[model samples]
Target: MAESIRTGRRKPAGPLAYAALVAASLFAVGPLLWALSTSFKSPDAVLTDTSWIPSAPTLENYTIVLFESQVPRYLFNSVVVAGATVLATLVLATLGAYATARFRFRGRGASLFFILMTSMIPGIAILVPLYFLAVEVGVYDSYLGLIVVYTAWQVPTVLWMLRGFFQTIPTSLEEAGRIDGASDLRVMVQLVLPLAKPGLAAAAVIAFVYVWNDYLIAATMVSSDDKRLVSVGLYNYLSQYGIEWGQLTAAVLVTIVPMVVLFVLMEKRLVAGLSAGATKG
Candidate 1:
């Protein structure tokens, strides 16, 4: 009776709210279901089939994309680029965030403001300068150029997440480490990192997804076929004459699966990180 009264005190979600939620869900999921449906159909059936269920579903599209195309190589390239970006961002952001969280120095506010500003800057504003710099540095069409750009772009996310997490942590832990003769770097790597797992995981996964799915920078910076990231490589199915809808949909589904799996695996930590990062010290 007490629980019922407490529940009753809360405002009831009206029918309009539920309707809007259902509509939004369909808006997001309808395309995904259609893509999944299209991926299973043969080229002829793809056009003819209005129904979601295929008359004869097959793995032929996936098979062709995986075995007969450069898609696997593109996947590997994406992995390398994303991995490199994550590593680079982690290294830079850890030092920057730790310093920002732990120290009070000249221009500290300005520095943080600058970091936030950079994150807000539009990609288009920097694209031309980055492209020219890449060409001049001979990293155009090279993984190094994209890795560098992605690293710079993603560092602010980690900084925001890690700095907030670091602030929430008890400074006594670092003091204890120092008393035991551990250096700042040692305390960070051995002690602090273990506790900041949620933030780190959140940051790394966000970086991975951003780098993996990014098209503008990757497509603009690199023009070579073999060096193409998965997002750019998906365009291989398109021609001036027609679109390979089956292959395109199959590729899209395949590209989405890994990120979904990664998110599911780290969902708890991601939620924790986002919540903690939302609040300032």
Candidate 2:
């Protein structure tokens, strides 16, 4: 009877389910495939050939973007800014989250709420003020300005995420550390942080991606081409004469490579980190 009930409850795979999955996959990857096709086509072919498969493919676009343009510089700038932002956000968020998770204090709930609320405020709303502030503070048109803004914007969300992850950690571990005469700071550094590696890895990837992809702050904060990020640097392909679609698409594909590589390498940790807090709160 139990075997019959289990068989009856199992849903059979349907053609419609398979069809929907294929359609969704195409919809998501369609643009990327088109861009890849465009990047391989020559200048004239890009406009004349509307077919998904290019009639004639060339390496000219890749050659120009890699060696002839400022894309490499822009890429370096993005890496620096994103890396620094991740480090700063993790440090600040980890400390703040640890305090919130371990210590019982007055206004803790209110403080966490306020921090999360800051993230809810649309970044666009403060663009002008941030621009003026960066200028007034002497950090305008510099990597420092971009890193500082990105760190400030990312910290609140990361703090809340980490706080949840910290809660999921057992208090008995910390108690054991205390029994060994370890200081709170040492306990956190040695015991808590090592266990929270997955959460930290997840947070770092998120913060890194945010800074790397942001266009507005990179554009508004830094006017110099030398300090421009990859997102804003892509605009260089558009000139008064016309747009270089082939080169632009090639650059786009190249820019996506780093993120793809990162996701591939950190997929496991990211999944674990994201799910770790789900059961706690």
Candidate 3:
């Protein structure tokens, strides 16, 4: 009886589990640490030790990348595109998610399935057609084009995430709001959305990160130097003769800093979003 009770009560924190966690964490963070170290190190240090710690840490690479290259402008462009994508995606995704979760409309499942199907389409396969559409519409090589593409591409997943969240919101809350003389739109604005704030935040952060890190669309859609987003603009640091590893690493880190900070801020919201469905159920 004692042995059975002990076995029943025991938790599963074994050496192998800890080792696996450590290995996964290292695998995920290794590139980031290497990049940060390389960014601070002079080219000579990279060639010599290649250690995480730089013998002579410096900000020269950051200064050059920020000031000398058109990186600052590209950063601005990326921020604009990402911001637009987030806002547009939130607006569309929230409405769609709410409708899908709450309404008993015709073809709703079909619409949702169609949305998810788009994700399976290889982006490169449709590039030529999308490029033509952009050119024909006179939005080629523009921030507007990138924003539209990112918003359209990401809205489906955002909708799925938010639909789950909205579904988890008690129907009674909206009913109570209605009993208190609230319309559907008002109920959504005042009650349902406020309740799903964490999920919305999670969706926004995901959209922001997606748009910010997208290189393929940014490279293809916006060809002008002035409109080039950060991901594409970073390619300027690479040359055939040799790569400016120091500057490139610095630029990469700089590009990632904003998203990292945002993710840290939204970590709680992300966790809440994950648990929302279970709690409601």
The Cα local distance difference test for each model comes to 0.87, 0.91, 0.86
Q: Name the regions of candidate 2 deviating beyond 4 angstroms.
A: 1-16
lDDT of 3 by residue, 186-258 (tens): 9999998888888888788778888887888888898778999988888865652168789889988988898
Pull out the clashing pairs in model 1.
none
State which candidate, 2 or 3, has the greater lDDT: 2
State the lDDT of candidate 2 residue by residue for 1-281, as single tens digits. Answer: 74577468789769999999999999998999999999999999999999999988899999999999888899999999999999999999999999999999999999998998999989899999999999999999999999999999999989988998999999999999999999999999999999999899999999998998898888889999899899998886566227889989999998889888998899877877888763466
The model with the greatest lDDT is 2
C-alpha root-mean-square deviation, candidate 2: 4.1
TM-score on alpha carbons, each prediction: 0.88, 0.92, 0.88
Instruction: Give residue 186's error in model 1 in angstroms.
Output: 2.1
Tens-place lDDT per residue, model 1, 146-244, is 999999999887887789988888889899999999998999889888887777887888899899878899989999899999988887555521787
Among the numbered candidates, top TM-score falls to 2
- Candidate 3 local lDDT, residue 50: 68
Displacement of the residue 118 alpha carbon in candidate 2, Å: 0.9
Error of 1 at 87 (Å): 1.2
RMSD of each: 3.8, 4.1, 4.7
